[model samples]
Target chain A: MNKINILDKVKSNVTNFFQPKGVFDKNFVKKPLIMYLIFGLLLLAIPFLQEQGYIQFYTMGVFGMIIIYTIVALGLNLLLGYSGLISLGTAGFIGFGAYGLPFFSNLLGLNFTGALIVTLLLSALIGALIGLFSLKVEGVYLAIATLFVGEIFLEIFRNVEWFTNGFSGVKFHYPHVILLFFQLRITVTSFILLVLSALIVIALGYIGFKKYKNKQKSKIEKKENRITKIKSRLLSIFKIALIILGLMLVLQIVLGEPLLTFVQSGNSITTTGFRGYLKLEEFDRNQTFRFISLILIASMFIIYNIVNSRTGRALMAMSRSEHAAQSMGISLMKYRLVAFITATVFATLAGTLYVSWFTSAYPDSWTLGFSLILIAVVVVGGYKSIFGMFLGALIIHGIPTFYLKEAFADINGLPFIFTGVLIIVVILFYPYGAIYLRHDIKRLYRYLKSKIIKFIHLIKQRIQKSNDSEVNEDE
Target chain B: MNKNTILEVKNLSMYFGGLKAVDDLSFEVFEKEIVGLIGPNGAGKTTVFNCITQFYKEDKGEIWFKNKDDEEINLNDIKVTKVINHGLVRTFQNIELVPDLSIIDNILIGAHNQFKSGILEHILTLPRARREEKELREKAHHVLEFLKLHYIKDMYVAGQPYGVLKKIEIARALMANPKMIILDEPAAGLNDVETDELAGLIRHIRDEFDITVILVEHDMGFVMDVCDRICAISFGKFLAMDTAEEIIKNKAVQEAYLGGDDFE
Candidate 1:
């Protein structure tokens, strides 16, 4: 009984000392904000690491690409991971952002801000339209429809010089900015975008208003006048804002007045005004990597917040069982559209970031192959994990391009073979994703810790035995 | 029983291809009543539950329900998700809780409709979202506490024992603050002791929440023990709607269960 008590006391002390919770045990790597910050910090440090001769300079560029794609994958996680909606039109819409920006800012003389706005609007509109068309079909059929959409975008990018500048690609120089805040370049082009967004938002608002109207009008038949009074005022104010926005857009396009573009530097490398003061001398890949790193981190924060909230629960519920979700008052159609559109929006933003780095848009880059690699990233990373998505991006994207190619420099075909085999092995072993490797890692850690403790106990016993013999010799 | 009808299913029918799963079935449930829907295996009891919950689309007839808002609305007109908005919630027969989520998180799903925060608010974890989350979390905890499930709230629904899983499903339905709850086989996999406790628990829930319950079960003793009224059906046709004693004494119910006096 005394021996057992001693052992129990020792065990309790050991457990108390090693307990991780509240001491980073709540989870260090799994903690949301810290993980994103670390991701951004590591990405930022890559350029410095390159300068220190630890990594190659080309690594900065690849890391930049990873950052951009990480942004896209984060959004795709919502659709693929949360709602379980498989969409293949990602490359198409991202290309839209990449091409749309240059098309508007370079060809049409819009500033950076205007170009981004137009690009975002165009991507959202097209995505929603496609979501509306394709989302009616469920499961693999939805994937097939989106596949068609992707192929169609690729064909359009190949054929239409107006959008993608054809095979030669669209090239334009982006002005160097201190923080994107200081020299926030505003650019032009694409009335269809501004009009489309205004129309869609107004249409949605109107529909909601009418639905509310019907509900209230039905609920309290006698209080019709009050309902009309409150609803009309809100709708009227909303419509007035829309009208004003419409008029301003018309003036900016038709009259050619610099209404919004504070810069108004029409396709000129040199700026002359307050905008000139905001411009930095140059922007290399290193700086771009850091900037895009911050961008990726910010998006990760947003996605994390979204995935932990009520909306996220609804999405998971829908993904797991549509019947239960529907019975719980989760409208499948609305959340699906939201997930799809949010995905496309993020893809477009990533495209915008990609163009910001490369200063060019190429049809060759935004292909079906790139889209599949994205899916592979989410799959390998663990669909439900945000941090795992980042790791997945690095592994899937970095292996084939950087490490594998470099290691097997002489063997031209080996990298592809190795990457394929590695992916298969990882998937086979960790069916959920590489993120699940943590479980095994923790188990190994515990086993090793116990082994070390046992060794210590043996050593202590040996020392005690030696002391006892020395005491006997002295006696 | 409350004199006012809470749910009126008039001539409800559902068909799958050429099969008439429910052919012109009708029933009524009153307020604050523990009602049992008993039928022989494949008598369309589950089909009726599905149709009432709007999980299955009906081919014919009207399902009028007095919602939590005290508004009598047709269940057919609204979306499936909207049924819960009207304060009607149901538990699945097969325990449909997402295994990935914790017990508390699973329960929060039923409160999905009560959340009024916008998408942006949710994405940002703004004050409104935070407030709603805190409030609902407390509510879920309260639900867990009521069901004696608080100790295991953090555990994932996966790998939980069958009895615990059933209790968790019930807790999830209760999170909606439902005016009416439809339970599909609440005692299917449960042992006798659990079933007996479940009978008391059901009565307690009806009394405490002041809500009506409609459960589909095959356990005749359980139904007889628990139900205020037992509605029997055979081949999608209404057999009898009466108290347990009357249902037991009824000849049609006897014939339906035991293959009539000829078998004897």
Candidate 2:
């Protein structure tokens, strides 16, 4: 009882320390803290839930779904938010990844790990080809062209049996990791995988926070110290690389038995079920299932990194004005292709994760409905805000699975009705998304401050003029 | 005088279906001379600049530029992208800088060719790309310092005045390290004092950089002050080309000006 209270108190204090100050406060919610705290809490809470037996069934399902959609959102953000390219073919790209996974993993005799990487590269190559057209046209034309491409991809997937095994779909199986005399099964259980990936998502969120804040600070400062600029950029990249390495190491350790014999019977132990054996009834034993979440998380990290880089800024510039971007001598096609390719890579990998988890792949797995949900997430979450998109994925994809599906089903049009309501509410009330509402409120406060400054300036000017008039009269 | 000419236009014409905007225009700027292109409103003064810059494809005739290593190249045959490589840079009549990009970034865009760093280097954030980026930034800083625009190095083009933006455009054009610069109405929006400052800047750029400057201006006062030689054109035909003093006294030049009737 005492231990639980102490833990609760520590959590509360940590939250208080990082929580944003009042909207009116000038130094409210430093980005780094906000980013770390939000994701950190989510990570901590997951393991805690597993201890209480309250984190089964849909927890893994919902988390897995969120990871998938988050990847999709990351890709779409590159298109709509960064590269100024509007795409309606997200479902098609995701379907490509899903369908491609089976061919590489089963038919080609490639392991699950090999198949995932191959799927990502293939999707990126194809996406770059399709995204090439964005250079020639823009607005409705580019949108329609991409939409057509998506439709064509779907048609190909549905008709082609050899590659995708037709409309029925193909099941996935794990391959053993060969290491000298010892054989290691690379299959990952759901609970351990989710926890490990949740930790990674948290770490990535931290890295993203550091990057975004550093960028914002540099922009505001203008006259940045040159050494600091070089240092910060290098440090930011180094930190990202370090975090990725750490996540990979953790995945490797957790995948092998006897991974953790030291931990007490606490929340972490309950969540991982790692006691030198696969005897934990509460957690999954399939190594592939565990790895799917981790792999998806890793893909999410790549997406986040791309979104935070200089190329990302170029994407944003292109999105705002293609003519201006081109006039400045930026290769419009190169950046557009990069954005599309990056986005497709994320969706493809996410689809791979989805397939690996369920041991199945199909053309209809990521459909128009799935694409619409991703678009909704991007719009409602806030376009261009990567962490916000992840948060949005959690709320939109996670909540619907846990609580809102019944309410959605009870309605006549089901999920579409909720989506419609969400759009109207978002567009009308919070046009910038829930994350930006805090920013907007802060902007309003700044506006009020500027007005006050202007008023004070006017008064000072009046006083000075009056004093000057009196001096002239006296003279 | 025609023997050492750096650029020569011959019978250049442009038409938009029925409207002959530029008809049979011809002129030449001598090597190292600061030349002025002057004309009444709608007399295709800027159209000639656009033609030379290859921003417009002429319907007729040829535009020639004397290249380094002494080769005569046809400007009309060259694409806009190749024009910069030919050591000719142009500033627009209206400033067009990327608003979201910083002033230094705007200048660096003009210096795109300076860094021969490959796409792989840019992507991997390799040492060469990093060093090249820093070098380009330093060059931009130096140019901005020379122009006295160092204070706004980090500022975007939006929220700046028309005059400052114009200077930014000039600074950007200079980044290409052109052998010649074509400036369109550099003193248009500036007041008398600012115009005087600009006059000095024009002469300084020409003398210090050893680059030929070709200017188009409706501000006759400025044209008379800064131009080493002046050319007056009317109806896409060259009326006069001489020292500013001689062009001011030329009968054809006077007639083209007063012939408009609207001019006093």
Candidate 3:
């Protein structure tokens, strides 16, 4: 009896651990939780292993890139998916920020800390202006207007020598902190720890979502209510755990010191007389990459809230039919402005990130051709889902360059060509992107399961009736 | 009628490239009164509603709307957004609930102006903004209850029955908390039972809320049973304006109906 009681208590506690609250109430389950936990542990081991020379340094770099792209993808999802504003100039916004942030850092000597703030504010201002103008023209015409903005910015970056460091590009130095009295030295291990901490900070966001879904499910008697509540809870907790695990795996790689082993590879031109590759001595001080990632995460959360708010609903109504929205006492122009402004804010922050990471501003980076890639990420990920964009970024930008670099290394621009092809496939086969695909697939599975259950219930009812009739005959 | 006058129109006119849609139309709607605007197709009944809502720019018109605070606003001077702010909102002939959004979400959108917290507040989700959001949701639920649409509150607007969609639209319009609601056609596509329910609902809306109601309906029975006064129009011109009994006896209105019946 004691053993049975202990087992029951353990089972209940385990179930409770997976239960989601608030928004995540609908999806808590066992399978998803296990998958996320395993995945997160694997990832968290990466950097430390790289440091110990067990994993490649490029893998960690790829992870960083994925984080950044995920942020951009989330932003685009709000503009295109939730609010129905199609923008093709996403890359331009991100690239502008990326290039702009680094350039500001170089010229002002404010280091990454000050430059990050300045870069975000400037991007927001520029984004607001662009949004204002785009609202005047809509549909294909608005796309053209944004296209022109990207093209114009690219031209300026290329031609303007002083602002963009010309075609050859500019270089930047990182900042260092030392104890005032003790003169204690700061190390690269500490920097990697900071990055790891950021990943954990980001993963905690799943907790918030889980809580929200659970709260909603508790209020309604929807048919799929209980199942959905379980699923949401499980998904969020699983995602969080998986993220932690993934970071730990990455840390293991970093501990092996993968970047330090680059000298052993065929790229030993550094020994002869080449400086193309980044030196570890200076790269450690540069926090632009991390700051960019942080900004992307912040902006995405804000955009998501705006898309679900009253203003977002009004924008969608306006998008459907201007005449009807007007009848409902919604000002069409006001709603249009809201969509434009929201999208532009995302674009500007993305641009600043680009400037900061590359330590240079280049016109070609913000071209329409480049910006279309960002749009493709949103499309491939699922335009309406922020989570989908994160997945899309991983598929389009992360995997191709990181895992498959060797296959296409000899071919010029093959990665981009592959991304373009993927975009086409996603648009045709999965118009909503990867996130919607997952949602639809899950919904279908649930529907099938419920049908089976109902059919079984009917059979049982018939059997019970027959048995009752037999009992009556015997009597 | 002096104290009763809530919305007064003088020589209201609207033209689309010399084709006068509303030609020198004039009318008055009183506080807490249910007024019906009935006419044949293209008789400019909808155009008057459009003009009042400022959906279309009028060629000429003077509209004075008296508020609860006893301030009279020149409706012509007020922009479309301000129309709602001034406590005047309208529904469409076709249900105009945001189709992709949930029924509850549609109602919340109608209450956009009521929640004055800006983008920053919403993004940060400040205490006051959250409080306002909670209150707004409660108000939306109340509106749904008033219209008997609370059951389908969580359902998406797509594929709903016409009568239900129509009620949902009314619920959404009420979210604006307007002093008066202009329903373009309350019972156009409803069955007998639904129409009866709609009539009861409209009366509840007026009596319980003490709000002015302007209905543009073709169903004469519904209009006669519910309206405090009736206005009949023909060829963008007003033929009769009086009590339901007076409208029924008016020779001008009878002739106008006869004239349109042959065309139909």
Interface RMSD, Å, model 3: 5.3
lDDT over C-alpha atoms for residue A370 of model 3: 62
The lowest-lDDT stretch of 10 consecutive residues in candidate 1 chain B is: B255-264
Classified by CAPRI criteria, candidate 1 counts as: acceptable
Give candidate 1 regions above 4 Å deviation: A1-30, A51-54, A174-282, A463-475, B1-3, B262-264
Best by lDDT: 1
Predicted candidate 1 versus true structure: per-residue lDDT over A8-104, tens digit per residue: 4444433333233323554656566876787677777888898899987777778778778788999899989888888888898788888888788
Between candidates 1 and 3, the one scoring higher on TM-score is 1
Q: Considering summed lDDT, which 10 consecutive residues are worst modelled in model 3 chain B?
A: B255-264
The C-alpha TM-scores of every prediction are 0.82, 0.68, 0.74
Regarding lDDT, does 1 or 2 come out ahead?
1
Model 3 alpha-carbon drift over 4 Å, by segment: A1-55, A173-293, A324-335, A358-361, A402-421, A440-475, B260-264
TM-score of chain B of each: 0.96, 0.93, 0.95
Q: What is the lDDT of residue B213 in candidate 2?
A: 93
What RMSD, rounded to one decimal, does every model reach?
13.2, 12.8, 12.2
Model 3 DockQ, alpha carbons vs. true complex: 0.31
TM-score of chain A of each: 0.72, 0.62, 0.59
lDDT of each residue in B1-264, candidate 2, tens digit only: 266788988889998788787888878888888999998898888888888887788999999888765678998777665677778888767665666667787777677656676554554455566667766777788788889999889987778887788888889888878788999899988888888888898888888787899999989889989999998888777788899888877888888877734333
